[model samples]
Target chain A: MIPAAFEYTRARSLADALKAAGTRGTKVIAGGQSLVPLLRFRLAQPSVVVDIGHLPQLQGIKRAKQGTVIGAATTYRDLLDSKLLHNTHPIIAETTAGIGDRQVRNRGTIGGGLAHADPASDMPAVVLALDAVLTLQSRRGKRSVPARKFFKGPFATAMKKDELLTEILLPFLPQGAGTAYESFEQAASGYALVGVAAVVAVSGGAVTHAAVGITGLADTPFFAASAAKLIGRTPNKEILRAAAAAAVEGVSANEDIHASAEYRLHLARVAVRKALTTAAGRAG
Target chain B: MTQTITLNVNGQALKAQAEPRTLLVHMLRDELNLTGTQVGCDTSQCGACTVLLDGRAVKSCSVLAVQAEGHKITTIEGLARDGTLHPVQQAFWEKHGLQCGFCTPGFVMTTVELLRDNPDPTEDEIRHALEGNVCRCTGYQNIVAAVRSAASALRGSRRPGAAVSGG
Candidate 1:
């Protein structure tokens, strides 16, 4: 399969990438795991592809007192190799490991995954639950976009054409907080049919805070505020099950060839229940 | 637009003229005539186009040649040296890991990375590592055995600093 002809420009630095993107009909290429496939299928025909895969400024994992900042270009392989991620935010490592196999993960980047906003991608739900912040920059200036508002819909984001997502800032969990990501993968495509990411903060035997993020069940990955009703209550099995059931309270399930809306709703409940239980257990 | 891109494949530098949209798999196979890497699925689902890009396995079909300009690439042809087969190739040959030999190169390259990362992977790990590569034949039993055997052999006979070519 041949992709549509386009001009390719490699950006040696962040400034160069932003400048290239400012041109009309230009798209930033990172990792190329998602965009290249789209290009091959003619689903996306950007006249100019700004390659930012080699930018050094956007290629490391750094943790400060505020939170962990992951360079947008950091590949899944880099995340897996980070001791800080494994120890501090192990859910990121666990979720990334479940993405497309070794080859895809080797070339896929966190920023690309989040920016692509694939409903079935593992990172969106996890990042949403983490309340991560995305840093967008351009030749004009820079601004921060919260994960909650970053994703507009499937394959759509709040980012502008001239801007580039340069970093993702994920806040560190408070003490007694634990997070887990669970997914039910569709065997053939290796994508999550239903995935849930839960963050539970327990204090003095009570659930102080609970955040539930769900994917592959709607037009976009979303937080389940209804599920967080467990706050100020003991998160027992029954309560956790109720929270899981409330996960898709106002959202409509996505129907596809692999699953019906009813079936996806069912799987969402199961995944949420499992994720919350595991997260609560880890919290203790 | 056509561009002359230089690729370091199998420890040798080769130059080819390719359009900005040219995939690395096409450059390796069509331009350089290194046909060991196959393209079973151009959409990146199948691992037949898998190769090492800077010491890691990536689907060549999914990466544009322009993106890989300055990176080191290692394909199946880069494994052997001086008429001696790589330990992985030897294991596959002895274990009948392949039935048609079409998917052999991809499996070999993927296994090279799996073993390098985890020298002694269990049966489940081997299966997980091979999730990207699809083999319609062999049911993957022999392929797992071949990877296990190759891991054992490499641990015993591998020469110091003799890494896979271009890796």
Candidate 2:
């Protein structure tokens, strides 16, 4: 499974990486979990591969003004080991733990995953629900993209080929908020057949903030606007069920050998219901 | 184009020339002549190419040889010392953990990490830890038993006055 021959640049710094990335036909390689597979399969034949996995600037989880700033290159294993992430956004850790397996987690990066924008990947829905912001860097300049606007389609993103995703900014959840991610995974690949992330903030026994993100049910992971229906309403079983149903309303499920479109929608509804219930229970 | 990359394998600093596209598994088996690591599923789904990268288990097939430049890589061949099988290897041998023996290296390497992180793991924990490695034989029962045996043996050796068995 050798990849096609390509020039490799081991970038020593952020500037070096950005410079290399700006070159035509250059592909950034971080962690190389997803990109390596694509390279091996000949699905992507970049003339140059810029290795940025070891760049010191693109590492670590830090406390920020609004919430937490997680380096895009931070691995899932590192995320699991972070007490700050566990305390501030436990759902990130919880969802990451279920991605692929131990070996994959050791090498997969959040930035790589988000930039790859695999519709079946778990983190897109998570960041969407968390309302995370992504910082993109390039030789030209820097810009920020909210997670909601990041995914354009399967294996596509708002990022330009010359830009690199540097940091993911997870905004602090509202005071009374709790977040949870739920998924029905394909048995073999562990990719989500249907995944949902819910952030519920309850205030005075009423739902104040409700955001739902869904994946594996369409061409791209999306913020389910129908979740707004729960706003200002008491989050009882009936209300939660209705909101879950509405979350998948108008969504066109993707069909494949793994599941039929109808079945995928069914799983999406079930997952939404479970995620919302669990998140509401954990809400302060 | 080939690049010379130096890697620390089994406490030895070795150098090999490989293309940027060369996978670490190929470099280990072909260039270094360490064939213990198998490539069951080249797509990284199967852990047949599992190896320790700086004391953590990672699928070598998924890692580029160039990416392993500064990391310490420990393969199944590195487990034994002076012809004596490592405890985890010995446990698998004694417990008949392997039937076909094709997936042994990966399972053994993965267990090396599992036991290192957790000296005493429940059956479910062992099963979950080795989820990446797949064994077609023994129904995973003997494999689980082998990990349990190795864990206890390693724990016992750590106690005071216990015979210091080589890792």
* TM-scores of the candidates in the order shown: 0.97, 0.98
Candidate 2 chain B TM?
0.96
RMSD in Å for all candidates: 1.7, 1.3
Predict model 1's lDDT versus the native: 0.89
Error of 1 at A56 (Å): 0.7
Model 2 off-target regions past 4 Å? B161-167
Q: Model 1 over residues A168-190: C-alpha lDDT tens digits?
A: 99899878898999999999888
CA lDDT of each prediction against the hidden true structure: 0.89, 0.91
Specify the poorest-scoring 10-residue window by lDDT in model 2 chain A.
A1-10
TM-score of predicted chain A against the true chain A, for each candidate: 0.97, 0.98
Q: Which docking class does model 1 fall in?
A: high
Please list the residue runs of candidate 1 whose C-alpha ends up more than 4 Å from where it truly belongs after superposition.
B158-167
Lowest lDDT block of 10, candidate 1 chain A: A243-252
Across A75-100, the per-residue lDDT of candidate 2 in tens digits comes to: 99899989999999999988998888
